[model samples]
Target: MSRTSHICLMAEYNEWMNARLYEAAINLPIEKLNANRKAFFGSILGTLNHLVVADTIWLKRFAAHPANYVALDMIRDLPTPTSLDQMLFTDIQSLSEHRKSLDQAIIEWVHSIDEHDLDYVLSYSNMKGIPAQKNFFSLVMHFFNHQTHHRGQATTLLSQAGVDVGVTDLLALIPNETVA
Candidate 1:
């Protein structure tokens, strides 16, 4: 496949892993889910919420939307999106639906941008009002990396909470149906 196709696949797989993590998270009690037991980021709920926000902000960035630093702070205030008792019945139903919608939207936006657009420099003044130069391609890569980094933190919170979220390895995305 082409470079864009490869990127799309990677992004799709990342989205899938994130969906699975959300599934594993809601299996526990609300007290456990919201517990201040996470070793970092204070609470498991808060940390997962951060991942959701990061994805949203990066999705905006990837789409070449206005880069607003203020939205980054809005993650914590977004509310507990998962229902605990309902999760026993719903599993990851709600979270999976949202993730699927977001993932599809990302893929579509990426398809709209040509490879030439990747090199175009996007100059924007930061919250400090200082001008900064970030290549669209480089920033896009950072967006994906940011998702992986924060999701890892959420994974840690899950593990600490005694959740066995099996198999985060990327190679697992390829099944017996070989890519080659």
Candidate 2:
């Protein structure tokens, strides 16, 4: 698949998985969602909030890219997350709303760029203010991979709590190909 096509696929998968997870997560009581499960982020709600924080941070960074992506203009108005673990929302409902918005922005942002845009080396600093330069396409891959990693933790947590986000697989979203 072409680079842009791959990115667009990932973006779509990101939104689909998020919707499935959130739909299941919303059924849990507030206390259950907030209970510490000893996972990386400590609780289902905590993990979900971390995803929002991380996505926001990355989107903000991407906005600084030289292409001047119009799709990322909304990200400029989001509050900059001060820490990776920062809880942007206290409840799943509020967090899920923000997640939907971010997912939409991701889809639009991916569609806004072409294969050429992915070749540019994006310069951005870590949250600690340390600067680094990296290929834009690779960074975008990392963005999607990061979400999958944390969502795995979340799904495990939900399973422990008896909520199943069925078929959490990117392969499920991939289209079949026919030989010519």
Candidate 3:
């Protein structure tokens, strides 16, 4: 499989994991979901909101690339997240709804990428206004990696609340090797 294929797989994995996480989150009591767990984002809902914010920020930045990908065209109208910890949705239902749409957008955006596009260097400023230049593919990798990292924290938070987000392994999406 190629790098583009791997990114697509990761996008699908992201959607799959997010669905499970939201289902688990909704099943729990609202108070429990909102209760302060002392996690980085403070609570389950907070962390989920953070995920959406971060995705929005990165997707908007990716739209700045010269490729003019139609997949990212929708991102142009959306408001840019001003901070990593911004809470765009206070409730799980609203958050989950936007998450579903955003995940679909992510899959579409990644699908629009080609090997040549990935090799292009993307220059963007961080949330702190620190500018940097790097390979677009590496940034894309970090995009997915950032999601996985936060999702891991969310899984832990869910576990602490006695909610289980099962089968998070990326291997679940990988095809079995053929024997020669």
Please report the TM-score between candidate 3 and the true structure. Answer: 0.97
Better of 2 and 3 by TM-score: 2
Root-mean-square deviation of Cα positions for candidate 2 versus the true structure, in angstroms: 0.6
lDDT by residue (1-180, candidate 1, tens digit) is: 555555666677777877778788867777776778634455666666555555664454444434322323333233433321122122234555666665666655655656666677777554345777888877777767777777777788888889878888777875466668
Q: List the residue pairs that clash in candidate 3.
A: none
TM-score of each: 0.70, 0.99, 0.97
lDDT of 3 by residue, 13-105 (tens): 999999989998987888888889999898999899999999999999899999988988778889998877788887788899999999989
Ranking 2 against 3 by lDDT, winner: 2
Give the lDDT of residue 18 in candidate 2.
97
Steric clash pairs (candidate 1): none
Question: Model 1 — TM-score against the truth?
Answer: 0.70
What lDDT score is found at residue 74 in candidate 1?
Answer: 35
- lDDT, model 2, position 165: 90
Best-to-worst order by TM-score is: 2, 3, 1
Which candidate achieves the best lDDT against the true structure?
A: 2
